[model samples]
Target: MRQVVISKAGSPDMLRVVDVPLPEPDPGSVRIKSAAIGVNFADLVGRLGLYPDSPKIPYVPGYEVAGTIDAVGSGVDASRLGEPVIALTRFNGYSEALCIPADQAIPRPAKMPVEQAGGFLVSYLTAYASLVVMAGIKPHDRVLIHAAAGGVGLAAVDLCRVYGATIYGTASPAKHDFLRARGVQFPIDYRHQDFEKEVARLSDGRGVQIALDPIGGRSWTKSYRALSPTGRLVINGVTSLTPRARRSLRALLRMALTTPWLRFTPVRLANDNKGVVGVNLGHLWDETALLREWVTQLLAWYDTGRIDIHVDRTFPLAEAAAAHRYLHERRNTGKVVLIP
Candidate 1:
């Protein structure tokens, strides 16, 4: 089998191709013949050693892949063999083949295109879990999504439209037409304008009922401000993870004093209905049933054409470093897929 190994953490150039013996399926696992792999900003963070649980050097780093079931382990059904499937592996996705737990692999819709199936499930499930499961989005709700042209952003826009919500998205101006075409009513150019003011203006001062923010930093405060009195805010990323800002001594002291209390602020029983939730898809697999359920819904959406994900670009596996570089530059408007 061939895989991209991260022998060291730094630039995309550090990712190297290597050959290794094929891995056998462990009990309850399924071996997949790789078709297409999804490249994400989170994977880049993992490769750069910025992720909190960064793996040891010489690790395979990929989160999701779509492929065919080539074999099944002891506890898995042999009937699953040769089935098209997708799985969220957290890591080790950049390879010619892989064996993962059977439950982690969901059968791809027979009618869904292979490339779409491979790149679809992860981002849609993440968006669905955050918007539908955590936030309990309702029709007519005013919503705001940051990075609206990215994979998860487009999913959020599409899903919000399905639920009859009025959607507002923040993206580069060049990407606004794409967002608008996808049903986003207000597409704000975050580069040249303040999204906070734009959201308020677009909503006529009622404020958005929900705000999905994966871009963290000073943006956190603004995300909070964009919400209505009972609005929910979900934090799913910290691209702001890099060195950028430092707090004043007084601010640091206040943060230290409030940290413990702030951590529990999102409790559903709290008197304040306004909410803040954090989502990490990797951690959700602890409840395999939930992951399977979400994957099922995503596949159904793709089958029905309720969600249209524009795959802006794709690269063959050999050019993964170039793919990573493109994602880092933030130039693409949709999913960046690696065809193996």
Candidate 2:
């Protein structure tokens, strides 16, 4: 098998394609032949050595894949062999072959294409969990989504629309039309406008009921302000600015001194009832079955045309570096992929 490995963390250039022995399925594991791999921001963080839970250097960096079950290990049901599935792997997905626990592999929707299925599980699951489960999204709710043209952002839009929430989205001006066409009523150009003010204006002083913010740090305060009373702020990723290697001693001191002060801002939150929460899908391995259940729901929705996976681009397996660069640069307006 051939896989892309970041021999040392630095930039996309560190990704190296190398041949290795195909892994065998251990007990309670399933071997799969990957057809498409989802490229994500987590992969970029891994390359930069900034992801909190990533392994050491010289490791594969992908987290999700869509493929076929080639073999099943002991204690696994024999019927699972030869089944089409999509998997949520912590890493090691940038390859033609994979071995994962059976529970980590979600059965693909009947007749769903490999590419869409490959990219569907992670982002859509996050969107579903954040918008519905975490946010308690309700009918006629007002919502704001940052990075609204990206993978999880778009998925949030689709699922929120299904929940009948009115959406205001932030994206580059070039993606405004795309977002509008996808049910975003107010599309703000984050580069040229203050999204918080826009959300306030669009909601007519009421503010959004729920805000989905994947970009973390101080910029996230704006999303919190965009919410309404009892509105939940669901944050999933820290893509804002960039993930730093290590904080300087002075920077650390400043954070230690000022971190708690931000909460006291008089103008913060929505009507004194808003809340902030985070969703880290990679850290949800303890609830892997729950993720599979969400994947099944997303695939079912896709089958019924209630949602869609916008595959902005697909690169060959050897071009995983380019894929990472494109995602990190925010050039793709939708999910990116690697065809192995």
Candidate 3:
């Protein structure tokens, strides 16, 4: 087996591929042959050591892989062997082979290609948790999604569309037409136009019923302001604070200083009847029943084609460095994947 490891954070070239012994499944676990691996911003964050949850240096970084179960644990049914599935790994999904708990091996939708399925779970689940669970999105409500051309943002747009909510999206102008076709009713060009003003203009100055913000820090306040009275603002990420594929202490400190930390007074939220919601999918890993419920719903939606994964591009596993660089540069408009 081969795995990509980050010895230290400097540039994408730091990601190294090395051969290793294939892992064997433990009791109640299964071993899978990785066919495709999901490349997420979180993976890059971990690789660059920018995230607190990132493993120590010289670590493998990845969370989801779609492949075939080649081995099963003693307590598991052999019937699972040779089954096509998507495995939710804790950290090491970039490896060519993986051994994970049997329960983490989920049935992949037959219609979903391995390349797309590899990156499906995280973005879809994050979107589902934010819009459906936290926002309690309602019909005819207004919604704003930052980075609407990205994975979770696109998923949120589709979910909002299905629920009959009007969608406001922020993206580069190049993605404006694409976003509209994907159900974003109003696509604001965040790079040139003032998204807040545009959102207000589109909403007739009433503001959005819910806003999904992953940019974090200073962006959080703007998203909060974009919300209507009694609206919910969901913060899930801080991509705005991220630097390129490097870990500089000075850059990290600068991010800390420039990023606006949410310090809401109880009186304000109560007085306006407005709410802020924070989501960290990593923190919800232990809530198995909750994760399962949401994932099952997403899978059902995928099987019936109510929603689908759109892979922006695919790269060979050895070019993990290039993949990370592409995502950090924000060149891809949708999910990116790696084939082993």
- The candidate maximizing TM-score is 3
Off by over 4 Å in 2: 241-271
- How well is each residue in 97-156 modelled by candidate 2, as lDDT tens digits? 989998888787777778887788778888888988888889998988889999999999
Candidate 3 achieves a global lDDT of: 0.86
**lDDT of each residue in 189-279, candidate 3, tens digit only:** 8989888888889888999999999987567878888888999999888785455767667666766775656456687889888998888
Model 1, 241-327: lDDT tens per residue? 422121134533443453334433546326656788888887776688987877777667767878886787898988889988887
| TM-scores of all predicted structures | 0.91, 0.92, 0.96
Q: Which candidate is the best by lDDT?
A: 3
What is the lDDT of every predicted structure here?
0.82, 0.83, 0.86
Show pairs that collide, candidate 1: none
Q: Which stretches of candidate 3 lie over 4 Å from their true place?
A: 248-254
Q: Clash pairs of candidate 3?
A: none
Query: In candidate 3, residue 233 scores what lDDT?
Result: 92
**CA displacement after TM-score superposition, residue 214 of candidate 1 (Å):** 0.6
TM-score of candidate 1 versus the correct structure, residues matched by position: 0.91
